[model samples]
Target: MSGRDFTERDIHMALDGELPGEDRAGYEAWLAANPDMQARRTRYAGDAEALRSAFAGVLDEPVPARLTRAALGEKPVVVERRRPRWWLAAAAALLLAVGGAGGYVAASLGGGSHDDSAQDQLAEEAIAAHVVYAAEKRHAVEVPASDLDHMETWLSNRIGMKLVAPNLSDDGFQLVGGRLLPAGGHRAAMLLYEDAEGNRISLFVTTEPAAHGKGIYAQSGEGPRAVYWLDKGYGCAVVGSLPDNRLSEVAKRAYEQLIAGMIS
Candidate 1:
């Protein structure tokens, strides 16, 4: 298949060395000519390395008491007083996998279909939240641009993560405002931006999963295609009624700026 025809799944399989011989050759040829794909591959490889570093040690350790009890179908005698460090390490690995690539292929391979479904649900919910809030007239955001600092601080605290407003003026989109919305079990910050044409795009940010599963880039009842990405430790979804290419362009611009601002 041509590079343009490759699905996110194809890319993931290719990266994980699971593609068949011919498909693997095609992907390699495509990568040879596609710098963006190459960069994505590099990032995916880096995420794999991070995962190995974070959790490879856990494989050698005795299974945690809670895990052993759960595996044995026996209720633990005493409630585990503390969460195991392995869980935290695994979470970190998940964050890197989602943020860098798309999501964890290994997790999905291990029968974490629920996680994949959750990501799709997240995209849908984010789009619905965008449609509901972007139409507001008097109060689109909880804190207006006048209280930018307060808005950022309030959102950061509520989301349990720092927040940075993305600059979209160069692309003719101005920050209208932002508000907190419920997403998956965490509070997500939805920032609205509008262009001169009155077209609105919502940037949904949450710290729950960097990437949960393969995200959908599609047009649906909620609105136009939404481009989602995980950067640092945040899950970012950009939704608008714009065309797919336009939405991708805007998402890429926003992603670069947000990553730069947040990382630096």
Candidate 2:
């Protein structure tokens, strides 16, 4: 065992098979000392394989005319960018190993640059997911709170990070459950919590690679109020139907726990 502390991002890289061989050995040793992490790794490995198998067909499809034309500079066409989003959803729903898990479509649009791309894409998908799932009463989540352990593992595998649902009871929201959603070239894990009054909140998390964001970015749109923050190379957003004050407090608490839980 290396006896070194590994950050959540390190775990993600390991899961995605992006870790250097030396680092991969060390991470495996770390998982040996941590049984929970070992189990998480096993589950994640399966999830990754399943995702690849599910989307294997897309690789065989002929390139779309617009993409081909744009590549050759033959046409000035602005594609809607919605096609790939649904393919992601289709893969998630067809997760045979994790049967009956529904997924939400997430489209990644153009951001400022490579630095801002991941953050902006994650934020837009987070809000879009919250808008879609928060309205569901019967099927609010794919894996309910009862299966939170598995949900965490599933999401970690898909998103290439380790995770725990941050406690929100202190913030007046009880854990409802969470689902793994599609995020363009990435993936997202959405945790849904509900207040006693039935208001729902979502915490969206994914690894924010490349450029780190500044401070928290807060905004409100037609659907939900949201506060997004990047900490320790992870991108997270707190979104809810509550007012700015309530959402801000919730975001603060989530941020603290997220920071505290960073592997190193």
Candidate 3:
């Protein structure tokens, strides 16, 4: 009935509504008395909800034959990336939605589909980051925009590029800040922005060679809609819940500013 009596598993159980009824009151009381623990619980609950809301329909979608074959240890059909390939996005979604089993299948299908898989991962990571951080109130970013120069420099050095937070006031989104994240074996930088209505958008950038793709590609139906592209050795995606046209416009402006900055 006290903090000392509870374990980490208890916190997860409480958050998942799986705790015993007799212990619920004690857990709630303990959480109220521990603000830090309460904050952690809130963040975890938010992340879980975000992931659920983002991929709730993944289970209902029919599995692609290629993925199924790959899962069964058969070589997957190599698909060309002419247009925006949705199946790879779906595969990434499945990997996130189903956990270990999906991971095994993804590992099985990895080597042969390097390029499309890499792009899929970028889209997945971008959307996943947006879903997790955009919903946060207190910890939306690692660095605040007030220290824009410092943030840019720090991210640039970490991500191995001259990272610049694109100006998007014209799109009604002001720079909130940015954060550094791990992207497979590489480093990634993500800048967060929010409009007057408090709607947030995130731009995810990485230096992965495979992330270099043909043109601006749209990834949807997994989480939020994202416009991903590769330019100047940097792969980037602008992710938000905005309409397709609006998201594309913001992404285009961002891409232009980013490219111009690199050139200058």
Candidate 4:
């Protein structure tokens, strides 16, 4: 904590309250000198709050009988035992929530759209949009599929990330159109696509700078299977009723095209 400049490691330590008393003052001083990092600190604070809210109810849920039996081990039960599976799941969710400073998935293990974190909310919104629009007889999208170029250019500007409407024709799907939605207190883009059978899928993209580090993650919610990933300062999820394997394949192809565009 002396001589060398404060590192991101130090900031994380200070935020987590793991910094020692001797080093704490120095870290705080460093943070005070750098206004830009205040945003990062704020995010950490918000992540802590979100984690608390998401997991608070787990304590009150009834413990599974199997878990209680495991703890009791044939002994006559005296006090109530906790659910082993639930504890493990809660621990994982906590790790997800704080691990990325709240930009990544902190999804509820239950089949619900109320997880309330950035990535969780994005995936939920994506699935919700897809379900609502996919059933449309008409007016499935705000922008028509014919205006692919304008949709790409306009959305790229509004969301502050380069956009590409990945063509899914090889997989028997084509772009239907896209629209803007709200995510993480900012604008997110939702692109819809359809196959010959009229089965629809949606791609939701948002600005999430501190999302999952260096890889993609997939989650199945109540409605659809969503494969999500963060790349080049943005996060996106592909939501559909396709089998998990098929969804993964589509997500992989879309991811490749996006990365290629970024590289080019």
Candidate 5:
């Protein structure tokens, strides 16, 4: 099959190793020829690996006696071979059942860390996106800022929230462009900006809520600093290599505009 014959679904299936054997080679060649798609596939693979890593302990632990009894229910259950995604979903559900409400309650009750894993995942994704795309000079974003309207519409539709690239001219950064990204289990929109000095910042947005105790939190100690915040419609993290103060300024501007967009 020609490159044009491969649809978005086919690419994802290929990434998941679910594509038919006959069509896999053609899609593989297509992905090899397309750097952007190849990058996307890499991101998806990374996400899958991260998921596996997060629950690695579960694989070693024996199933709880009560859970086994509840599932068996006096009848033998035959386990069927399933896709990796299905296994990941099943593992996640099992984990929640084992850990309970993402360990918040268990942690609180046990006097352990009360950090929100979902918000941490969001920040991790945002930083990862920035590290991968911000360094690119030619293909930083899938859509250029010159086509702002289309970029806005496409990302908004895919991410399930009306998205507008926040104005940051006051902070000396201009919109460079934006792109769609796989953010764990959520579809994410990333808006890239550049300053006169050639420094870049990316605002990663997702419809999934990422609120924790801190309304807006700044991540410290890393290659890049990130400021994450939650909105009624979506959550966003502004990531850049700039100083903490500078990054916070950019994040504040983005937060105001995003909140205003939701209000109006």
Candidate 6:
């Protein structure tokens, strides 16, 4: 098949070794001649690596008998039994990966359950918000970066949490500005950052308490995917319509910068 006819899923499957042998060879050849596709594959590979680093431990840890039974499509007698060691280990792992020590500690102490569906919904909302605002010509942000100090304080106060714009220049994206958005009962801070090509990614943050019952989840739709985690008493959803790998890279960088700012 011609390169023009190949779908993104075909390319992703080929990179993931999920394609049939005959189709794999065709895609490999196509990728070899197509630099853009090759680049996308490289980015996806990096994202896969980052995700494995972040969550593979959870898979290897002996799932609690209850969790294992649930995964096997069996009903557990009691799903609410406390497993402090397992919870602590999971929180510690997440803290190491995201540098949200305070957030993790709060979550652990609160005995709350993390909700996967809620996190997914947050990501979807973030993407919808991106699509709505990225197309704006003059009113993308309520407060532009020109008034950086005021913008930061205004958003922090509005969200009831400190807000800082993560520097994304090393990744070819810079802060454009930000706006305040209402998300359910809590306020959401949407920081808009842009690359040289004018492509934009948004970081959606709110002070909603971490849902402790559900585990971390990664999902993608359209051109963007959301990477979400609970950090320091806040729920963070980093959303972008970029390739999966690029979005993960941006999230990783943003996590590091935001955590550093929070601690320092």
Candidate 5 or 6, higher lDDT? 5
Clashing pairs in 1: none
Error of 2 at 217 (Å): 5.7
Best by lDDT: 3
- Predicted candidate 6 versus true structure: per-residue lDDT over 33-90, tens digit per residue: 8899888988998998898899978878875565566578874342233333554465
What's the lDDT for candidate 3? 0.75
Q: Per-residue lDDT for 94 in model 4?
A: 42
lDDT of 5 by residue, 46-68 (tens): 99899989999998998755467
- Write the number of the candidate with greater lDDT, choosing between 1 and 6: 1
Best by TM-score: 3
| Tens digit of per-residue lDDT, candidate 1, span 24-96 | 7677777777888888888988998898899888779986666666688874352223324454354444434
Mark the regions of model 1 whose C-alpha exceeds 4 Å error after superposition: 1-115, 210-215, 219-222
- Model 6 clashing residue pairs (backbone): 103-232, 112-212, 113-211, 113-212, 113-213, 114-211, 114-212, 114-213, 114-214, 224-241
Runs of candidate 6 with Cα error greater than 4 angstroms are 1-113, 212-221
List per-prediction Cα lDDT, in the order shown: 0.69, 0.68, 0.75, 0.68, 0.71, 0.68
Better of 2 and 3 by lDDT: 3
Model 3, runs deviating above 4 Å: 1-114, 214-222
Winner on TM-score between 2 and 3 is 3
Collision count of model 2: 1
TM-scores of all models?
Answer: 0.54, 0.55, 0.57, 0.54, 0.55, 0.54
lDDT head-to-head 4 vs 5, winner? 5
| Candidate with the larger lDDT of 1 and 2 | 1
Global CA lDDT of candidate 4, please? 0.68
Q: In candidate 3, which residue pairs get closer than 3 Å at backbone N, Cα or C atoms, i.e. clash?
A: none
